[model samples]
Target: MTLSVRSRPSALAMVSALVLSLAACGGTTKESVRTQAPAPAASGAASASANPDAPIKEGLKLAFLPKQINNPYETIVDEAGIEAAKEFKAEAKEVGPSDASASSQVSYINTLAQQGQDAILIAANDPNAVCGPLRQARSKGIKVVAYDSDTSKDCRDIFINQASSEDVGRSQVRLLSELIGGEGEIAILSATANATNQNTWIEFMQDELKKPEHAKMKLVKIAYGDDDDQKSFQQTQGLLQAYPNLKGIISPTTVGVSAAARYISGSKYKGKVTLTGLGTPNQMRKFVKDGTVSKFALWNPKDLGYLASYAAAALVSGQISGGEGEKFTAGKLGERTIGAGGEIILGPPFTFDKSNIDEYDF
Candidate 1:
């Protein structure tokens, strides 16, 4: 329950409004820089053809298409985008399907494009399912930014990665290894089967298991809950039954992790089967307190959302060209440098347990 490592402040208070105000008002004294004026649109709405070299304008409208609407996790994340948009003097809206299906986000993407949205930040349900519609949106000049989950790189201008894929994947397996005494049968309760980030992390986890240090750790099965709470709970139960010797579980999705915890807490498997993976403090606090879950890791979803919004604004304003080494100001997050693949890392994932869970609320 105790982490020797220090914890950073949460994104809820990462940046003061004064700093954001200054950044929005064209402050360039330090890490922040002044943004250019937007180019004239060929039509009434902002046009993708408005001139590739033109600056992005202030007060542009932004629409967020998350993996699903009404999800507690996505709601909190998108709220951060809405808040960041206000800080940057832009209008922001969020829309998506209640169900998280591969093609669920396509219609919303088309709607935002037709509505003349200046930018569209999305948490892609599937990497390729929405790429065509997203490409169409980009063709019209809407800056496409992916957060939490990502579409294909060519489909989005920039991806705000919550953490490196390697870190997220390795950390979960490491945590579970320690929790289960380094050797036992473990299974994965994942999100959607085709989720880009989820699939990548699971791959890394499988690779991590192959290391000599984890030779005794056996992977029994990998189950998909599709990020639905009840479905994830059912998957957990099935995993426990399907693999009677299963010693632990790594749920890389917040929804899957929490659902697994909820099931383990009340079942006979309570302390026998350890659970660890990506989850929010608010969702996992009770599990940690009740001794159902020892620890889990996650980057600040709010910060991820904030950075994604800032990235979208920067792209819309033509501040950065989504190229490697492109630099931009991320308001309270201060200056950020783009890395290879047009991705921006929010930060390393934080470990949450009884000792530190209370420090975070989002």
Candidate 2:
């Protein structure tokens, strides 16, 4: 039941004119090829200026605010930004609250503004809850780059997308459908309900499930784990009890998927219920080895951070204005053009299964 769908290579071709010169940076890997459905040509404010002649600013003071501090996934992703900063000779620091609540990130945004940080990168806890603070920082000339998740368009200079929302949503359902024979009672375990990225992906997943081929499958419930391990574990336990015949679960958040795996591996549900979603190899290795999960998907977290740092540097240096046709050089990752909607995609999400799990470390 692995659905064969078309990819959006045409969108990549549309931005070819915006790619600046590519250069080698120390140990940079060849830019991972990105394939995403092109958004409609920019409209409204997003289409205002096609600044193709912006300059690259260097030696900036940068800060990253993830959804939660000390999250394993965020830790690895933010470290990549730190490494990129070092490579580009910029001063970089990571800061955020331990909670993933809607307004938990506002205070960090205010602090970075007061500290006169040249650039700020954040994974918004809620799309609009922190927009006011972010807009206030923008008013102070501090460039903003939203990574992993995004805020309101006016609040940030650019969004560093790990993968297209459509692809991520469709892929998760496609994989889960295959594992469960395209027919069963399935549930979704997601991050915060207010998270823009999580909500978008879930919307597409629900849409994908409505296709005629998947008519036999019924989505039973959608649970929010708030991206916390303890809460996610408890939610999994609750789902199992509430829906005794649940055949599969899709935990699209890294924390949610890993926590669900941990709970299932030790319970009687192991091997009886299928689990699939986004997860790092290190976090999901044991579950995969013990047959708790078949396959899952994720783009490279390091590349996501690396690109976000570059986007921030470019914005601070006035190399780009977050315009549709803007272009900037992303270190060893090479040249990246700003696409419609102020998005700079990293690449497609890769699947990690038993056969290829050992090949990835982050």
Candidate 3:
């Protein structure tokens, strides 16, 4: 997580990257920033190709939805699915709102159901709020899978998690605890307070903090930035000003973590402070490159969405259901199942640093 992220302000690099990617992709930057409506029923635009060697069944119309459209994490995951679809011969298209909002996603969910999609995979905007509609979609024979963030278990047939939430939290706590030498003050710059995965990870971190070795890493403040870089940057500054001796910061939000790292890197506290959290490799690379951040964590979102799409396609093709013991192939991703508490881990998180940063472009 030793990523040397920067800011004139912070983490706008992601937005900059988005702008550049969209421009290269042949769309106006403004339109590309939002997850537009699904392209007129696939339009037969070579969206469904043949997969001679793939394990997928043909003629599937699958929908992939993250909390928001056009986001770096969502964009990568969507692109990965596009590549997988070319190989698997399934009809995969991503759709979601311009911003991460429960109301917006709820409306989009309604549209997907109306579109008669074979399966729908989602990173829900709100857990409890979206459950009812998801359950209703299921009653209509649409396969429902939760990707990055989840809807409640009862509302979802399966949760395609990027990594174990507990694992993510524990990784951060262990790394941060080590950075602080097991003792000192710390804080959390979380995403929206209600985000299920973030909340679960933070709860796990709280429980971990009770461990004897972590007794010195006093978690001083907890703040929310709504995943906005500006807000996160402001909160980071606030934390520094409010808690002058704050030893470290664990920002479980991708945006929050990067913002904190950027602030810590350029501020007078550069070497004296430590920061870590869930962040993208591309977003965190420069930060790590400069030693602004020691280490941070996140399951690869591209892989997360790739697997989620495959799982949804499997359900559409009748390969498997969320039965007590059912295994399915996510193509190159290997086999996975609904484990205890209905969990589905994509894989373990990779810790980013100098040695491997260059290998990853996103």
- lDDT top scorer: 2
TM-score of every model versus the real structure: 0.86, 0.86, 0.82
Q: Which residue window of length 10 is worst by lDDT in model 1?
A: 21-30
Question: What lDDT does model 2 reach?
Answer: 0.80
The candidates, ranked best first by lDDT, are: 2, 1, 3
For model 2, the stretches where C-alpha displacement exceeds 4 angstroms are 1-55
lDDT of 1 by residue, 1-362 (tens): 11122355543243222112210011111132223333221111232332334454677788888888867778878888888888868888788898899999888887777777778899999999998988777776667888888888878878888888888898888988989889999999998898889999999999999999999999989999999999999999999989989999999888899899999999999989999998888889899999999988876677777888888888877777677776778877888877777778876777777876776556
Clashing pairs in 1: 48-141, 56-317
Q: Which tens-of-lDDT digit does each residue in 290-335 have in candidate 2?
A: 9999898776677777888888887776677787767778887787
Error of 1 at 263 (Å): 0.8
Please list the C-alpha lDDT of all candidates, in the order they appear.
0.78, 0.80, 0.70
TM-score of candidate 3 versus the correct structure, residues matched by position: 0.82
- Which lDDT value does model 1 have at 283? 88
Error of 1 at 269 (Å): 0.5
Model 2 / residue 146 / CA error / Å: 0.6
